[model samples]
Target chain A: MSEMTGWLLVWPILLPVLASALAVVAWGRERTQTLIGFAGLLAQFVAALALFVQVWAQGPLAMSMGGWAAPFGIALAADTLGAGLTLIATLVALAIAVYAWADSTPEQRSGGLFPLVLALMTGVAGAFLTSDIFNLYVWFEVTLISSFGLIVLGGRREQIDGAVKYAVLNLLATTLLLIAIGLLYGLTGTLNMADLAAKVAQLPPGAALESIALLFLVSLGMKAALFPLYFWLPAAYHTPLPAVSALFAALLTKVGVYALIRVFTTVFPEGFALTREAMAWAAAATMLLGALGALAEVDLRRLVSYTVVSGVGVMVAGLAIGSEAALLAAIFYIVHSIIISAALFMAAGLVVRSAGSADIEQLSGLYKGVPWLAVAFLLAGLSLAGVPPLAGFWPKVYLVQAGLDAGAHMLVVAVLLSGFLLLLTVGRSFALVFWREAESAATPASPAPGASAALAGGGRHLRYALGALVLLTLLLGLYAAPVVEVALRAASELRAPGPYFDAVLGTAELRP
Target chain B: MEPLIAIVVGALFAISVFLLLSGSLIRLVMGLFVLSNATHLLIFVAGRLTRENPPLIAEGMKVAEAGIANPLPQALILTAIVISFSLFAFVLVLTYRAHRSLHTVDTEAMRVAEPAPRAARLRGRDV
Candidate 1:
């Protein structure tokens, strides 16, 4: 790729960072902030798409900032996977922008919604694009601060309660991540990921390296909300506004997962059997526990929150299995989860607006009132549970095949059981929230104020956003071939790590 | 000198963990700051302390002369310090605001979300 093509990598991150400042300046003018925010996201979406195409056509693209070479300057590199994720995240952010505009009360719009959202996109894109470990740490902090502002934007007592836990836990998580980056730099005397990969390959697998990998796992795993480390997620995710929660649900943990995959596969590809085994067990536990938790929930938003945890388990499981097929499936599954979960939350938000409560015990007969929304909910729910011919099903198929091929029979069983439990969870929620009549439930949660008014009010944009996501899921289901191919190519590049290193450094640095 | 620094980092880490484990939210927040500093020092020692000249090279030179201090890790440490400082500040305010609103800083008392499990909470008291 030419230097011009490398600008594609910079624009997705730069535009959002600039737009965030612009949005802040236009903060009091809600109308201008909204327009500027939308324009920024739209431009980012276009740039991200261009990046995906450029990487697809030309292998990988890299730009070392300030005209310095790798191992010195920060390397911003994008392969098919990074660019693909950026594109998907941008599309989701745009959808959320539309929904947030409609769903955020006038008060929230004045409170810097547009700027916070744009800053969040900036962090996420930067995280995916950067090859410098320390720079990745910076991007994570950027993501963290913006998300903290967003989670508590409405300043409901519950929002603060949730934000406090979210902020404290994630702050600790990122701090550990920074410490890991620092230690990794100490060991290799380099912060560039490609350089570290080469240097670490020379060190014999020993206790020191093992300890570093453990630190990386705990930190990133906490961020990704794996199994025992995940209570913070269900606690905080339900407290935010639906649009804010949708953004968090879509991007946050996945970034952690991305970092996990990047560090593990790129830098430490030797003798990782023990950690991979641990991840397998964690994945199984996370899947089973999260699905069961979802099944046990009366509150609809918390129910969806648990599903996000379970979905993360499946992706981690795919990574643990570590076959090309499994990696491909994992990448494919991430895109599926981001879209479906965002759609599910938006659908649940609509239910909350109409029924005046998120408690399924209080919510009933949504299908009778809003059939379109009911369909949207059912479609999202089915896709989430990995029903055949949906966006979720193909990844599951590939994962099962890979698990069998790898002789991880137990993990295969775990995957199947997790999906079965998720089906039950989704089916029960659908019955309780949409089928049952309101008077029939034994108890109903007190309606949040203005719930009915919110439903009756002008929320056409909210509906449009939800519909666009639902349609995207269906399209993904019906046309899985292209996505699967892209995922496979991305995973292949990730495993090889040759083109990636060359892109960051120069082709002359390739060893073989 | 390195061993002394390591021992101090370890002691600080122990103290921070003890503080974080306390019931008081104020202590927990303070522990965060303590842990941040301890980790910074850990990184500092890991980079290998030396009383050598600062890592600087003349403009035309390709590399710094021998005995120059390692610059990369210092740069890493600086970035980590700035990031953690801002995070600590945000966290201090967040916990305080949460305490003000919820009337408690105790994590055990902060139960606005995810209360006791349904079975445990119900305890056969179904109405």
Candidate 2:
């Protein structure tokens, strides 16, 4: 209990913030920005791995910044779950930086893309690490602004339209979140999450805390793109460059899920009695609608965007289960979905680049040219559909088992139905793009719409980055023992908040 | 004071929601602006507005007076206001740019991204 590992918690947030500042100083220099962003993520990834290992061994690490005591100063804390997410986030971010650098389209390079991405990384890292609800809101704004900047990098009519919707919805969400935080502060007289938890559990169950919880749910639901509010996701996600889309698909909604899990598990663990039931229903609708949306889309990016929403629904259902086993499954699913979705988006980008269009009607046999890419794409599709022996399958298996254990019969059905629906949707896209041949093969200089795809120039690096991540998905599936163990431990820690409280408050208060 | 502020906050939120539901992009922007201001007011009121006795501790005092106002909420509101200001600025520029490029300030005409129902049906055979 020497409180030595606090530096690990700070490194993830500090490096990115500092790098963002440096990137600003070196602004408009694409070369310098790319280097700074990549190096920052590289450092973050390495630091995250070290932090994860440390947290797994030590339980949780926290520090009151500026040497201020608990309930007085800002606290940044990292448990197994937070560190693991930071690690995965940085890994994905590193891949995206490399892909965007490789893309080198003038739009990709301009509008301070690297700096904005670094700022986004800073926000995401801060969101995961901060132990104060108000601090979490601050990080949410940082993440939102940087994302808006990245979204409008191209300023195309479509991108601006997408950004408008994205900004309006997300800004509204953050505004509501701030209100929720203010109310929570008003109720408990403390903003530190641990202090609030201790204070909340002391208050008798009442409407005040319940209303704040609901506000948080609505706020986070918008961010997570829960049912009836997910139109903006599909509208905007596909308009950005593939690398940017991949980053958003990988991390943005997941942050929403992260906030939900963090708040429900930490502050309102036993507080929000009825919210879980509403969330369970919302989760089911989200899954069904998201899958059906995917099923009906001919545009590849749009299909994948719907899949992103579907994955959020699955994670949300696990959260609603609120059991340690269910949480473990949710964590595993988040990891799996992040990798698969990023890989799928990158694959679709290559397809769009090589084919000159992502319209399914325009696409034909891709197996003939880039056979390796076709194989990679097929693996991603199967993995997303939760095929056995893939990363997506195990998470669902755990989710189904846990749902049954919890007697959440609807959740179980929704989970299974979503898996099956995705299988049909992704399988059809795979077949249409890779299997069918052009009937009139003798006509044009460009390969037949049904012909195998050729890898467009400058896609070599993109494929390398994508291949690395997809290989990770395979590795996750084939050898999931360590990850599962870690996830289970994280869930168990969440089940008991004593350690989280102690970690943030340190040993000073442990004297009985 | 709290009740009056609550009513005002409610009114601001109501108008913003009404504006938000309109099809005009300008209205949408106004909706967000009004919505953010209402939220700030809500936070201000929720923090329990006390008249003018700030929670500053003198240099010699070990502890501050108990009845002094809670400065934390004010700090929180300040941070929120700054953040929302930046976000609103971005949204304003975005709306103006969107209008310039898409040639419409109407959300209904913002279908540059959405698929047309007719197109979806005609090509719907494969999906």
Candidate 3:
């Protein structure tokens, strides 16, 4: 009820903004920047945990800016789903900050990487917390711009090309998203999501509303790297610095997935049956195509990027199914994929640093030289393949179960086949990097100067980060019930719009 | 006035879409700019196109004749404009850099780096 109480929802969003400001001031001082990043990350993580506790204790929390209520002023809301995502985002951000500290070089330090990184985190956090539809667009742009900065920080030729394409395509998506927001605003006369959800149901099903929803689907679907819209992801994500790539691989696309899930479940539930079927088919195509692409790739980074495409299928399947179980599966898989894919990228970066090439054919016998990293890579790889007891298994089980319950046999089958393809992809990489004969291995005797320093000394930190992620992945698999429970609760709350609307619109009996 | 704004909006959308579909990166960037501007106009119109009144309420003004424009759409458009402008600038530089490095502005030519072959070997023989 209190404005200050509602302000707690904004902490995750504000943390990165403050950090970005600090990072700008701390530019040119590496130690200062590193300390700022660490302190900011720690503070955000603690704040996120506390906010989660508050959300758990309290129902949905809403904060209106300048003391104006919904339909008049901008507001921010945090539901259970938002809270859960904020928690994962902050934790992943902390891991990335620590990893960057351990791995960054003096050149990277001078390149303004830290500031961009903080800004990127801020954008992602803001996108998750903001309650207004228009504000979501703004937050999304914030994420996109910072992502551009992060991708191009090193100024590598490849990084520039990839970043350009990424920037251009995402700009297009953002434009479409803006159009959709405008259409929705025009029709409903309200930009607040809760208010729109309530009003939209009263509007007649027509071309304008349908177009708005379709536009949103296209835009957010591109962001989620759904099948046909995914061409930019593999190349763009493959070129950035490992830490940046890792974080993006883990978090950025998932934001798209999160947005899709949130909007589909909350605002567009009436037409969701048809939407789900469409999405399920897209999920199938995406899964099969992504796996086949991953199977074809020889570059480790690009292979991981392709896997991201395939992984999107799992989340899409969960979303399209729309069952409580399916939603839970999607949430579980999203968290698992974030941790595993990040660790895998970090490991691949180590390989690139040591072997001087990300070309799988050119690097071999890393298992002998870097046992710890090899182990971490194998764990992430297996988990991604959905091997038992790892993070990936539980989500697949639930998703398949949901598909069966919903009588979506083809989707279930597609999900299983993609899992096997992922296995083959991971197995092939492991064999090439670990099991091949040394003479047949491609190992660069000496990498470019400073590569070793960047790659090797961070073993302790990488180990710690990798261990933490792997531990969470395994624990999530083993203890899937609590996570599933949280996801189900969130999903049910999303499915039922009455409570959310009541909370935002002050319990007024508005005309239907 | 509404009809004229609609016509301009339609023109912007057409030009933007045409440019976006073109192969030139520079044109594509311009397309994005035009498209975003059109979107902002659309949002403004969607908020019902007030001409005589501003969004602010003066002191001692009564509710009956206040007739202010909705400030929310204005705020949203301003934010969108700034955000899109910054994005446009960033992409412009990025496109320049990409053209310089990749030696071609043709997106078709940028596809040279294929995934490494799976059977390729590493450099070090002795583990």
Predicted model with the maximum lDDT: 1
Q: Which stretches of candidate 2 lie over 4 Å from their true place?
A: A1-4, A271-273, A439-456, A507-512, B57-66, B119-127
lDDT for each residue of candidate 1 in A1-512, tens digit (9 for 90 to 100): 55677788899999998998998888689899989999999999999999998899889888888777667888899988899999999999899889998888788888988899999999999999999888998999999999988998888888888887898788778878877877787788888889999999998888888878888888899999997899899999999889999999999999999998898888887537678888888888988899998988888999999999999999999888988999999999999999988998899888887766787755766666677788899999999999978899999999999999999887789889999999998888888777665454443532333344466565778889999998998899999999999999999998898999989987223221
Q: What is the C-alpha lDDT of each candidate?
A: 0.86, 0.85, 0.80
Candidate 1 true-interface contact recovery: 0.69
lDDT of 3 by residue, A1-512 (tens): 65556667777778767987988897788778877777777877887788788877777776666657566666767778888888988897778767776667778876777777777777787778777788888888888888888888778888887887889888899889998888888788887788787788899988778878878888999999997899889879988888899889988999999899878877787654446667888899999899999988878999999998899988988888888888888988888888887878877877777666786765666666666667778888889989998879988999999999999898999999999999998888888776665443234543334344555676678668767887777788788788877777777777775665665555222111
Per-residue error at A60 for model 2, in Å?
Answer: 0.3
Model 3 chain B is weakest, by summed lDDT over 10 consecutive residues, at B112-121
DockQ of each: 0.57, 0.71, 0.50
Error of 2 at A446 (Å): 4.3
The segments of candidate 1 whose C-alpha lies over 4 angstroms from its true place after superposition are: A440-453, A507-512, B58-66, B118-127
Q: List the residue pairs that clash in candidate 2.
A: A364-A449, A364-A450, A365-A450, A365-A451, A368-A452, A369-A452
Question: What is the DockQ ranking, best to worst?
Answer: 2, 1, 3
User: What digit string (tens of lDDT, one per residue) describes model 2 on residues A351-407?
Assistant: 777666777656777666667778889898889989978899988999999999989
lDDT for A108 (candidate 2): 65
